[model samples]
Target chain A: MKYVNLVVIFSLLTFFACTSSDSDYQVSDIPGGYMPGDTARDFQLKNVNGKMVSLANYENAKGYIVIFTCNTCPYAAMYEERIIELHKKFADKGYPVIAINPNDESEEPGDSYDEMIVQAKEKGYRFPYVQDKTQEITKAYGATNTPHVYVLNKDRKVVYIGSIDNNARDAESADKFYVEDAIKALENNKTPEISKTKAIGCTIKWAS
Target chain B: MIKPMKNVNLVVVFSILTFAACTSSDGDYQGSGTAGKHVVGDTARDFQSEKVIKFPELQEYITTSTDDKVKVINFWATWCAPCIKELPFIDSLRYTYDPDKVEVLLVSLDFPDQLSKVNKLLQRKKLSSTVWLLDESDPNLYIDKVDPSWTGALPATLLVRNSTDQRIFLGKELTKAELETHINKLLN
Candidate 1:
């Protein structure tokens, strides 16, 4: 009788442990909100010179292309030439490409302001290479990955968010240029057929 | 009576075998500290935290979950920028929610060498949330175990409320509004 009672108690404990809680956790899915018509949030990030720059600072701009990049991501490095091209193609036409390093220097020493300067100088980045000192601007823009791109209209709202293109692992078969298409559509005053995409790159490093 | 005794002996042998098998493999984490130390490469300064759990039975340290509370599990690395940016907001969320109804667990991915840095950051920020350093070494083996599709991203968050359902967010940062909205949705 004692043995039977012990078995019963053991089974009851197992059942309770298994059924009482279903709080098994997994990694979360990407947050969503942006679409073809969403307006971009205004931001003030410190430039390489330590001056705060905001959307209002570019008063006469037609559009803005904000790219969340870093000094370390190989994928972002792959797109450096493309980024320069975009700035050259659009800055005089009223759309200026802005690059922001959102990696925390405390966690990623290579992404420090001084390193950013060296990288910009080496790559000859003509556009503003801003530093998100506290990463407030990066979070405000909903940028989750390095090389995450956001394109805004003249009124400063996010019209496009995601990768520079569909290709990152290989350049030989690189076909889609999503950011370019989005900018062209914005220039033509039409909705982009594809407004968002999944950015593939290194995860943003946060400070401990 | 002899035959019955023989049968009883067989049952006893089977039970012992079963117990041995279960206890030997289940929760028997024998892989202790083979994850390689971070060597500075061309990319950046890499710091890895120690992986050996000094206390083998530390799993018992987790408190029992309450019925009314929702637990937020955040997997982060000290070097991840978005994780750092979103942490203050997460702290703010803890303050905003009722303590009895919400719990936040911050799991650090720092190398064992950086425990001091992690502790210092927590102290500097005055974070009161429960903090734990994940002592597993092999991320490639363990990352998928955490979630098959995680892709080893930092600033990953898991929201749980007693096994019925859970939500995962893989990204760099989250705003207070975003965090609150998701928490509310999950509670409902």
Candidate 2:
């Protein structure tokens, strides 16, 4: 009788598990892409200033704000000033922004290294505007959208991943600052309540 | 007689298989009614009626079907090269399939200020399907509500038939054959 009871309980548990998972299966839960607590690997790419930048170079940094963005994407352009603000606000507080353009120049000539340099100069970017010439780092980070961000700790662990803020249309109207909140959480040595989010962005133009 | 534990195990396995079988054919059902007859007329004139809608309006648009037609909601933007490239393929479904069966809605993700650009492109492309610009200011709020699987990437599509409980979300650029395969799967 006990064995029969045990079997019934096991079956019920298994049945419920299957149904629950099926109903709540998120596409983001699929493999690839970083979830919170995932340790991100370091990358080496050239900056617009003719210098190679990497996470390893930041010896005294508490964490890094690595953003995959490019020129010509209107969405990215909208976030340009906000990204600059993030660096200004947090760079001295231990987290600095490292912008990388992952688009292929062949596909989007405007996103070429020279254009990145021009944009950075024009915008007075205080951060490194690097070029992911190979886009291998982009694949590793699983960044599908341009202007996608990954907030990492000193250990290179991804603490928050997604858009810069809640509002992409008008920055002044944005109520929630996702990246800033994540950085604040890290500053307090507390895990962010909301770690992952999604934003509409230009699909990272892959080389033909 | 078989042992009680063995019998329970058999029941569990059988139930799982039955559930799987039932779910597999859930999308395979004959669509009811014929209300999707789209009038063959001026393509640009039809597209001129496009409007900007909020997220809740879009939700109602997807769930509440006008004719029990399968909803092919393609989320695209004018600036997205691949999305522009695939617009014709998605638009092709509007004329190729029975309007009473499949209702293709090209939902543009363009900013409200870019309405003119969207209009010019649609007119240039001669796209005939109904279009709407999702006016939600915050993508974080609406992106997941569409489908948790979506990463907020451009050129995503939602194929849904609520009456039959079928919702297939594709978050990548699709080819012509792939779109046809999905439509056929949803239809029959």
Candidate 3:
């Protein structure tokens, strides 16, 4: 009887452990290890104008500043102008910023394609405000959050994966401009001092 | 004949276990709290039926509970289906646990306009758990403040036994078994 009780307890423990392990939030590590030399993957995403734009469209560009942002996240909103400015600063030098809205429209109605266009126009976005229709591109890029950024080299490989800068709440408190520093380093043919940092923003509303 | 019967029984047990595991993982118990549709950017005053607490003071409320008890702060929203489903289970938990040892705090992420509706829902459910509306407008700002690693997902939970060791669960809906296990582990 004691042995049976012990067996039952052990089985229950195993069951709980298995369940907890299965339910444990298995957040995928942002696929990293892509250095300055790796080639970037080419993807075609729909622009706010309902036009598909590919990496090849930005021909002869030195690099690409791919940012996964959305209409709602305050963090993304705060960095909107900064993103535009980054593109304006680098577009002439052959690197143009490409913005993608990865939030599912079904979950967040404001993130619908029409709303994206409206928001883009309202914000005066000069860059291509693309929509990840199936969120295939977003998932492929492993963009889990709005305002999650990836600086890909001209070769199309991810050179940096993190925030636009250090400050999301207060711009004044930002000490290290990681994105800017990475872009400058890439331009200089030198490796960025810091390659990654945790991104802060709204969770991407995937069609689960 | 007996061998065949035993094999059939084995199959039946296996199927039952599989169903239980699947349901345990994904099942949510639906409650009777239906929220009325309210457009975004609506004023806090528009929805007078729901209770709205001052947003900034939520943290203080959670942290500064005068009672010496374990606080289970559940972040939920009326729009979220899983959150609605978990309320009854949470109420059950509140009933089962000792009030002096455990306190359940249901922090609604519902818009200020929907507060009255939520309050009515709570009242209808006869839920006596200490409830508060999270008044923070922007999740991006407050989500991190709540926990730097939080992804601002609804139906998330934070179980605080004090400042030192707190368990944070980020997901939609939790089963009674899972809740019991967590509570037992923490309490023990």
Candidate 4:
């Protein structure tokens, strides 16, 4: 009986290690993170509404558009209105946009908790704009840039990762809507065809 | 049928290798299009050119395939505070390091509209190293080539030592001493 228990535990450990993409955790070397199909981790962060929220809070959510975005980045600014639109379009479909400001506030005053609230209010963000005070969430997600989006499936699998769209300057010029397309595919019970793309924006401010 | 299958496998492998090779070597993107400007044999002055490199030209740009010159390529943007702060160390690197042995390429990650602003900043700082505006639209396409470890982050620097063909990537802000230490280690 004891031997059986040890075998069961060891097999479980091996299974997890194999299932977790080595690249997602190999973030010790480079900041690139969370390949498609990796399971998402749950976190408790302070939302702009002053409520402590976690992934578990969304009981009815089919999926999530978890964006590592902030107030200071021009790239984030470029996508702010679009992000709000994404939430509006998808929130009713059980996919809501959760914006997290992971930058160290001491380094970036514009991204301070107070400023986050101000930005959310000014933009009239319908979704929860949160803060990762310890940066544990950011590091776990392997978020390297602002406006980096990770689409989570109903099973909590990261279906897609990378930028919201191709165009940074003008939305009218955007030929590819990576995030929207991914969400639509997920809604139809299909995996996103393009699972990963590069996210270009201000590097997440680390407390060096 | 067997012959075609073999060829298909080769094509797949070559595509993967080509992608890996160019990710860090995209520093060589500007090496072409200049006619006898600073040929390897020539004693070059502080090399700075205003040439614009579109995405099409980038497909052919690989500086490592050439001769012995340590290439230091930095990917920076005007909006990034750390990138702006770290520019001087790269500038100082031009004078402190052996110019004949080292070649610095400061590639600005500025957009097309920001060209005048980037040029103004370069002039204000009096940066002597050759500067190039990264004209490619999709950063995802080139950021990996810039440095596979780089998450398209600002203040990413790539150092290529010619003799041993060593390529090193630093994807964060660095002080002057840290810059010197890295280059010296590369040289040795």
| Best candidate (score: DockQ) | 2
Residues B1-188, candidate 1: write the lDDT tens digits.
00111223434433443553456422112222322222333111111212224222223222244465677767775665567777877866667888777778777766444554564465445455666676543343344444333544566665666534444443445667777776776676
DockQ of 2: 0.28
- Candidates' C-alpha lDDT: 0.63, 0.78, 0.65, 0.73
- Judging by lDDT against the true structure, name the best candidate: 2
- The CA root-mean-square deviation of candidate 1, after full C-alpha superposition on the true structure, stands at 17.9
Give lDDT tens digits, candidate 4, residues A1-208. 0112324433554565678422332223434456788898988999999998788899999999999999989888988889999999999999999999989999888899999999999999999999999898898888888989999997779999899988876688888899999998998999888888876688888876
TM-score: which is higher, 1 or 4? 4
Better model by DockQ: candidate 2 vs candidate 3: 2
lDDT of 2 by residue, B1-188 (tens): 00112213434433443553366422111122222222455332343346778899999877785566788999998878889989998998977799889888889887665655675577567676888888788887788678766788888998888776666778888898888778777787
lDDT per residue (tens digit) for residues A96-118 in model 2: 99999999899889999999999
Error of 2 at A191 (Å): 1.1
Every candidate's DockQ is 0.05, 0.28, 0.05, 0.24
Q: Tell me the spans in candidate 2 whose CA falls farther than 4 Å from its real position.
A: A1-31, B1-42, B65-68
Cα deviation at B188, candidate 2, in Å, is 2.3
Tens-digit lDDT track of model 3 for B117-150:
5655664555657677765543434665565435
Q: Could you tell which candidate, 2 or 4, scores higher by lDDT?
A: 2
Candidate 4 Cα misplacement greater than 4 A, ranges: A1-33, B1-48, B55-62
